[model samples]
Target: MKTVAAIALYSFREAVRNKILYSILFFAILLILLSVVLGSASVHQDSRFLLDIGLFSINLFGDIIAIFLGITSVFQEIERKTLYNVLSKPIDRATYFLGKFGGIAMTLAVQLLLMAAALSATLLLRGGSVDLQLLGAFWLTYVESVMIASFALFCGSFSTPYVSGFITLGVWLIGRLVQELAAFLDKVEEPASRHLLQGIVALAPDLNFFTITTQLTYGYPVGLAYFGAVTLYGLGYIVVAMGAAIFIFRRRDFI
Candidate 1:
């Protein structure tokens, strides 16, 4: 456990030095400021528009950072031959994998907090208040990003960084649209095709379940039950993804 913690801290510092993370974060803040500007132009529904755009910007940029960092976490080490040195030490393969995952997750959590703070400041400046529902929305967004990070880690364990990034991005896009895909599957007349779609739906992460932007924008009430259900779902998927990553990493020959 101590070794895992050390590696995790190292990973966190390594990720902090990545220029791409800052680039995405800059754009995220820029977009949030732009939302404030655009929101001011509207006579009515300004707050709604600002909150919607701000939340979307946070989610989008956070996912980008998560995916990029997760894919490169292992690949960068291998490319630099540092992975061999680390593996030669007392650390077990599972510990190394978990450390990397923890580092990336920690980095995402920090980034999410920053973005959420910016969003809150923007809302306050616009005469809006941060309520429990708004905080819940941000919490769910962070959870969603964490899930993406885990998926990226799973892909990185077995594939090159480029291929891993592509696969992770594809999964993310599909995960977000899984509901629409399921709807289309329901219209399929062929048994085999329907079955395949059903399989995809069952296997894919239901990202829509994490989405609360619409309700937040419209000031609708979000139930605690909904949050609990999605939180459990996200945690379950994250565990599976991380376990798969550890399993694959243990089998790989670093030599």
Candidate 2:
């Protein structure tokens, strides 16, 4: 536990030092600023556009963090031979895996907060007021980002950073389309093929549950049960991804 916490703190510091973190922040701020211009273009997306802009910023930047930071976490250590050095200590593989996951999760939380604040500022300036449910909506988005980070970490365990990043991105895309694909499959006449698609749907992460940006933009109530279920699902996926990362890392040759 001590090792996990210590490593997590160290990883967090490293993540902060990485230039990409700041770059993403800059881009997020840019998005917030542009929201005004974007909102003015189309009332459908802009007048109440702060929420959508903010949610999009979080989702886009969160994805950047997952791909850039999460995928490189372990591979960077291995490239520098730090993984071997760390493992030589009293630390176990699981602690190392969990530490990376914890550190990235913490980083996502910080990023989410910054994005939310920026979004709120834009909304305030635009003469818009956020409902309380907006907070829950943002939290759900953050949770989803953490889940993506975990899956990215798992891919990083055995693959190159590029491969891991691409795989994580693919998973995110698949999760987004899983429901749509299922519906499409149901309309198809090929029973066997449709059933195969159904199986994939069951395995894919239900990303739609995390995407409440539409509701936020239109000021819809996000039910407590829905939020709880989404949170539970995100945590469950995070655990599974982290566990897989540990399993793969245990067999990794860092020498």
Candidate 3:
């Protein structure tokens, strides 16, 4: 427990010190501000339009941070020989991996909160009423980003940072389209190919579950059941990805 906490703290500090973190954050704030400006052009109920833009901007920027930093977390440590020094201590591979994951998760949470604050301020300025659904949407967005972060970490455990980045982005795009792919596969004439496509879609993550943008924007009810299911799904994927990362890292030779 002590080892995990210590490592997590160190990782958090390292992530905070990175220039990429601040650069993305700056751009995210800019996006939130820009959303407010664009919202003024709406002809009807400009508050709804502004609120939607604010929430979506935050979610989009948070995702960009997760992909940029999460993919490099482990890979950067390994590349810089920092992993060797850390491993030379009393820490185990699984503990280290979990700590790194925790650190990245915390980093993402901080970024999301910052974005949320910016969004809130933007909405308030536009005379929009704050809705609890927006908060729920933010929570769901965070889960989705964390899921992507775990995938990136899994890839980084065995591949170069550049490769992991590309793979993570590709998987994210595919995850959002998995349902569409499944539907298309069902319509295919060939049985064997259809079955193969079905199998592939099943293996892919269903990112749509985490998407609540349209719902929050339109004042739709985001029920608790969907939140529960998405949370569980995110946990399941994170566990699988972290397990794979640890398995690879345990056998890595840093000599």
Q: Which pairs clash in model 3? A: none
On residues 64-103, what C-alpha lDDT tens digit does candidate 3 reach at each position? Answer: 7888777888888888998888888987899999999888
Clashing pairs in 1: none
Q: Top model by lDDT, which number?
A: 1
- Report each candidate's C-alpha RMSD, comma-separated, in the order given: 1.1, 1.7, 1.6
Q: What is the lDDT of residue 167 in candidate 3?
A: 90
Question: What is the TM-score of candidate 1?
Answer: 0.97
Superposition error at 244 for model 1 (Å)? 1.1
Q: Judge candidate 3 against the unseen true structure and give its global Cα lDDT, from 0 to 1.
A: 0.83
- Ten contiguous residues with the weakest lDDT in model 2: 43-52
Q: TM-scores across all candidates?
A: 0.97, 0.93, 0.94
Error of 1 at 6 (Å): 1.2
Q: Please say which candidate is ahead in lDDT: 1 or 2.
A: 1
List, residue by residue over 92-171, the lDDT tens digit for candidate 2: 88998888888887788888888888887778777777667878878888888899898889899989898998899988
lDDT, candidate 2, at 37:
88
